[model samples]
Target: MTTRLNPYLGFKDNAREAMTFYQTVFGGELALSTFGEFQASEDPAEKEKIMHGMLTTDSGLVLMGADTPNSMSYTPGDNYSVSLSGEDEGELRGFWEKLSGSGTVTVPLERAPWGDTFGMCTDGFGVAWLVNIAGAQQQEAQP
Candidate 1:
């Protein structure tokens, strides 16, 4: 395997639901492992909780998530955002629409100061996202 950067999200107990929703949005193959499935926890309450969930899309997107064990603290914040950027406007816009559908759009998708169509939103699960659609001129200028 080659070096790759994949986003891993931590949820209190909704990792399964959140990851499922992502599969609907991104059209990917999702694999989930429960705590009990791997004997990862002795607590019955966490037995069914997701220990790890990964969604791998045909478009080369890999997103992972897991439920936070009761022994650890989970904090959702605005310190970070997952970004999607490319020259495919239609594909990127489709993602933005679904992601911001039941959530909040912090920035409307439009022409940005940098010349790309950009927007930011928080998904229903409270994960922040940034999408940028590269402009035609910008794409042509790139080598």
Candidate 2:
């Protein structure tokens, strides 16, 4: 497998729900491990909470998430945005619709000034996303 960069989301308690919702949107295999299973938490209330969750899609998308332990400070969103960019209009648009429909579309997906279809949204899980289709990104000049 090739090394790739993907988003890892952190949730206070809804990591399982959020990750499962992402499976529906992206059509991926989701594997979740609970705190009890991992023996990571001694609190009974947190035993069932997700310790880690990974969603791997056939399209080479890996999205990971985990529930924040009670000891850690949890803040949702306003940190980073997961960006999806490619030339596949159909696939990218499908993702945008599902994601935006579930939450808020901060920027409508349309022709962007950068010569691509661009949009921004924050999913129900409080995760920000930027989607770009058929982008004409700057390329290096040939020698």
lDDT top scorer: 1
Shift in Å, residue 77, candidate 1:
1.2
Model 2 agreement with the true structure over 88-123: per-residue lDDT tens digits:
666788889999988999879987654567787989
Cα deviation at 46, candidate 1, in Å, is 0.4
Point to the candidate with the largest TM-score. Answer: 1
How far in Å is the alpha carbon of 80 misplaced in model 2?
A: 6.4
The superposed Cα distance between candidate 2 and the true structure at residue 37, in angstroms, equals: 0.4
- Whole-model Cα lDDT per candidate? 0.80, 0.77
Segments of candidate 2 deviating more than 4 angstroms: 78-143
Report lDDT (Cα) of residue 133, candidate 2: 72
Clashing pairs in 1: none
TM-score of 2: 0.53
